[model samples]
Target: MNDHWENMARQGSRFFGKMTASLSHEIKNALAIINEKAGLLEDFTLMAEQGRGMDPKRLKSLAGDIMKQIQRADGLVKRLNRFAHSADEWVRTVELEEALALILSIAHRPASMREAVLEAEPASTPLQVTTKPFLLENMIWACIEFFLSENQKRIRLIPEKTSDGVRIRFVGDLPLPESSGLLFPGEAEKVLLRALGAELRMKPATGEMVLHLPKGP
Candidate 1:
């Protein structure tokens, strides 16, 4: 592979690692809760065996808590699985709305870390696009990262179907940088845009940045 593609691959791998690490942490948290619950259950069992008596209601509540953790881990796994498979194909037809939601799911934690709320408004109808799914996610995440770095308090994403293409707009509560030209769509992002055959439009005055992705070629 050439240097450019190789760099992109390495970048994807890094992103994958970061996400998996975050997921593992979350899953671990759930597991730890379950373990604590198990210990309580064990305590209850011991009490019953010693004739000290155990509350059946407490046992039922503990079981429900364990079930909740299991369901949470299951959801995390499903999302991570979908994300991993997004890299399965170099290019494919992807439903834009589903893709947008997936990226937001994975990015919610990061956005929260920056004290920013990440919200999305889905298109009235599903928007489909032929593109590099992995790279496409990376680009959206790059936009999320950019907005998260801003002084803005909230970042709202909306995917719209346009006559010529699809416009994914990121709207913020505060004004985008007056010098967004200098800070955003950096060289790396430009490379990604070229790779995806996409365009980035920044409306700093309106606190909006739009990514225009063309339909299948």
Candidate 2:
């Protein structure tokens, strides 16, 4: 089980690293376009100053578009940075709401691309817990990603009371029979979760998935 946890961590690092790299590449392209557009605007302004006719409004519009893309690139870089630091600690108390929010934010792109909405309940109280924050975060992330990749219509994180602690119910459209094995494809993720003392229950027949975690100290 410890091996599973370690494997999960490695897999998660690789996965998120790839994602960040891709986002960085996209941001770089956006910056290149912005640079080009700015240069064009500068040249157009220079030509206009020389009495050569130029549409100021058109130039303004192009510059505005460039600004929009620059803003987008900035946002992507921030998100990438946040996801990259998700595994900063081995064990600690993390606010459940904040953690969940981060997971949702990180997953927004793929979730939106797949047309899947994540329905979260309104919990006024923070669900704090002391555990392997990185592993727990990855487990939740994996579950959500699994749902999206399998083409599930939606996913929900419903909290419920459990004898030992809290049970997070992940209810979504049933995944294909063949897709079950894909839930924890690598030993890394599984071992990590096991080391953190987590429980996973998948019941396709009941259209239910559960992650049971203990309350924080």
TM for every model, in the order presented, reads: 0.95, 0.74
TM-score of 1: 0.95
lDDT of candidate 2 over 43-153, digit per residue (tens): 897998999998878887997989898898888788777666766766788776667776676666567768888877755455667777666767777777767766787
How do the residues 71-177 of candidate 1 rate in per-residue lDDT, one tens digit apiece? Answer: 99999889999999998998999998899889888887777777888888978888899999989999998888888888677899999999987889999998887
Lowest-scoring 10 consecutive residues by lDDT in candidate 1? 1-10
Q: What is the lDDT of residue 118 in candidate 1?
A: 87
User: In model 2, where do residues sit more than 4 Å from their true spots?
Assistant: 1-9, 53-60, 112-121, 159-164, 174-186
Candidate 1, residue 104: lDDT: 87
lDDT of 1 at 175: 85
Separately for all candidates shown, the number of backbone clashes (residues 3 or more apart, or on different chains) is 0, 7
What is candidate 2's local distance difference test score? 0.72
Q: After superposition, how far is residue 80 of candidate 2 from its true place, in Å?
A: 2.6
lDDT of candidate 1? Answer: 0.87
In Å, residue 202's CA in model 2 sits off its true spot by: 1.6
